[model samples]
Target: MIPTPEIRHVNVTRYITPLREGGSLPAVADADDGFKYVVKFKGAGHGVKMLIAELIGCEIGRVLGFKVPEVVFAHLDEAFGRTEADEEIQDLLKGSQGLNIGLHFLSGAINFDPVVTTIDAQLASEIVWFDAFMTNIDRTFRNTNMLMWHRELWLIDHGASLYFHHSFTNWEKGAQTPFALVKDHVLLPQASELDTANQKLKSLLTPQVLQDIVNLIPQEWLEWEGYEQTTEEIRAIYFQFLTARLAQAEVFTKTAQDARKALI
Candidate 1:
């Protein structure tokens, strides 16, 4: 069994430059731990849901044996970004004063290029299964959201995952539905072991594993701008959603398998 890892909290020591590659305007910041982290602010356009998704998605990937960056609860004080010259950045920091999400910076990591690096069948199948299980719509060939560090592929930008939470309604249907976008998954063509990945992964995402990931979401994230539910209520919804989804794992597995066969 893969042990559930602890998510640490850190204080932002300094705000570095913005990583403009992503739409959310994540930044490179120094933490009190003396390490650099790519921090995602709660003030971004997508709101707290993005941060919640980031925490849960990355945790799931980590538990599934993927090489994911360490996720942290980055505390941003009211005066954190006041020294920044950019007005836009100042506003972003002001709105994100409490807790945000950050991933340890993988320095010198280059974007994964399909032409230059090859992923084996097992890994590809697992990745496809993971994204599909979570309904992640971002990992397409147009923008793989994967990186190569020290010759090993690492996942990033998982804030687009757990898309069902964006609506937070009809979760039963959401859980029951198969992911139609598997056809566009960047790894689908190479995911020949979908059945194998399915059997192993289903057994790994036990009830305990799902609850641990849901528990990582900060209460502040649950208290977004215009929501009317207690944090515990929101948390319960997420856990149920995941539990229902996992019970129907084969629904998505078959979809991904068919998509791969069509590609071939």
Candidate 2:
């Protein structure tokens, strides 16, 4: 069994206010290092679900070779006075007080927009495709959890995905399970532009890289009591996803290459 990360105590001198707020996970603050990390509390409430979802989503993003913020789960040791349900959440908060949860901080360095481009359409298409393959449903126009840095698109906030697993009783991983999203998603911004981008991804998302990405996730994170089963299940699903995606990649590559030639 892998050991859990050593929980640490932190002194957040100044609580940098959020640029925006709402949703289960609130945007916390950008630290002195210039990286803006979102601080979210874990308790016997809705935020619990969000925290779990985000951890899973980021792991998936890492596998697909996207720039996800370095996520470290930690506890908020500081006091913010009191809120409405303060007493009820206190124990869980105290238990979590130096213990980790999901992402610890957000780097304010990078920012991105799905509707806009300083980022190439091909790269954007891959980001969308990656999200689709991972079953991420949060990157829509209303709440695109992505960032733009150095004119590059950085993907984030995947805590809203794999809902089928969350509500497994209501949803089945049927034949439609695999490519269902691919057909409907269509790699936003059109396939015509993304044709060339796929080629770049072929090299970037090699099998070794995929394995390494999965390895980056601490084993303890997957071992969380209730989530372990789903973690293994998702791992298997992703294995199949990667194999199928890559098996057809050669053909897809050829198609893209041909499409690129036609455009010229």
Candidate 3:
């Protein structure tokens, strides 16, 4: 297996502000490492599973050369947010008093506007293929989950991807399943190079790489009360699911192409 990737770990020193735009209420805060990060608290919204999806999906995108923000583990202690006035925020902080996922905050980033931004055919196609591979359904125009910093596109908020894990029953079926919602993908109209991207990108996701990505999931996340399976089983399932998905890249890629065809 390829060596597991290393993500920076930092202690959250301050809760600067809550980003109300997201349902989970991730916050922008300063870490002990002298960097500001948008920390996704484990106690809010989708809980630990969302953090898992965010971690795994972001790493996969980064490996595929997407300009994703640097993800790190932001540690929150019991005393960190005690002084917050808002009841909801305080409750969220109390519940999330442990390990959480954080993305490096791009200081002056703006939202990506499909009508205004210029994207090439290859890049769009690659992004489509990537989303389809991950079974992501949140890249629609309504909420791009993307940002532009210094004229470069950066992907963010992948917590909505890999939705099958929410139930995780019959997960074997999920790996082979085609992503139909890709039709609503914001970049579908411009994704003319899907087939080419399929060929190039599939070769890069070796089994070792897949394992390394899956291995990045925190042990505590898997130990949640919601799951009936053992931690190892859960981890193996993620690895196997991704491996099967990569093996069936043609299935999902073709589905994306068909979706694109319907668009144009």
Candidate 4:
């Protein structure tokens, strides 16, 4: 089993500016650690569920040897919002005056464009496999949430993944669900070795790895209404869902292969 990552906890010292590109309105904030982070507020429209998805998706990507930014738990003080001029931003700070998610900001990074940058076949195939396993629908060609920094590609903004947690009433429906949208993936055409990638990466995500990744999510984030399960119980549900998906990885792997074939 891979070592459990120690998630850093920091306090937000100052709110630098709002990143208005995303619908949730994430902001760049100066943390006490003397680093800048793109903070995802819990009060955002998507709520804490998005934060949970971001954390889980990031951890999974990291375990698969993908380039993902470091994530931290940032404590937002209520007084920090009083100085903000924008009412919307101030409200966001006020509501998220506690534990929020922060992603280490990559300075001087440019948005990845397939036209300008070429991804290697192996890396591309692994990334496509990972996204297919996670049921991530956000990595489409139009809004490729990828960045090129220092001539290397980095994954970012995984709030749209693990979408099954949004509604737990019929959560079982998500298990083993075929990801038909893999065809729209930005890297599908470049993913030439899906079979090899799947074989190699599948072993990395053992049950212990899945449990460890799910355990990284804050308990409060899982305390949604309409769920009868306790926080730990809810976490187990996520493990079960992922384990089921992993067991059926071949189904999604074939889907991605077919998509790549069509693109070629």
Candidate 3 on 1-264: residue-level lDDT in tens? 334679988999999999999899999999999999999999998898899989989999988889999999989998978899999999999999889999999999999999999789999999999999998889989999889999999999999988879888988888888888899999899999998999988987988898888888888888868567899999999998889889889998999888887777
Error of 3 at 181 (Å): 0.3
lDDT string for model 2 (1-264, tens) is 123223233433333543344444253543434444665555434444455556656755665567776676544564632342545334544444443443455445454444454455656567655554456666655666777655555676766665554544423342124433333332353444554555555565556555544444334444445543566665554444454555555444444445434544
- Segments in model 3 whose C-alpha atoms lie over 4 Å from true places: 1-4
Q: lDDT score, residue 205, model 2?
A: 59
Error of 4 at 212 (Å): 0.9
Q: Would you list the C-alpha lDDT of every candidate in the order shown?
A: 0.90, 0.50, 0.91, 0.91
lDDT of 4: 0.91
Each prediction's TM-score versus the true structure: 0.97, 0.58, 0.97, 0.97
Which 10 consecutive residues of model 2 have the lowest summed lDDT? 1-10
Candidate 2: RMSD to truth: 6.8
The local lDDT score (0 to 100) that residue 107 gets in candidate 4 is: 96
Rank list by lDDT: 3, 4, 1, 2
lDDT winner between 1 and 4, please give it: 4
Model 1, span 1-264: residue lDDT tens: 667679899999999899988888899999999999999999998889899888888999988899999999999988888888899988999999989999999999999888878899999999999999988999998999999999999999989988887888677888887999989998888899999999998899999999988987777788845568788989999999999999889999999988888889
Writing each residue's lDDT as its tens digit, candidate 4 over 1-264 gives 589877999999999999998999999999999999999999999899899889989999999998899999999876878977899988888999889999999999999999988999999999999999988999988999999988899999999987888777666778677798999999999999999999999999998888888888888888877768898888888898899889878999999999888889
Query: Which ten residues in a row are the worst by lDDT in model 3?
Result: 1-10
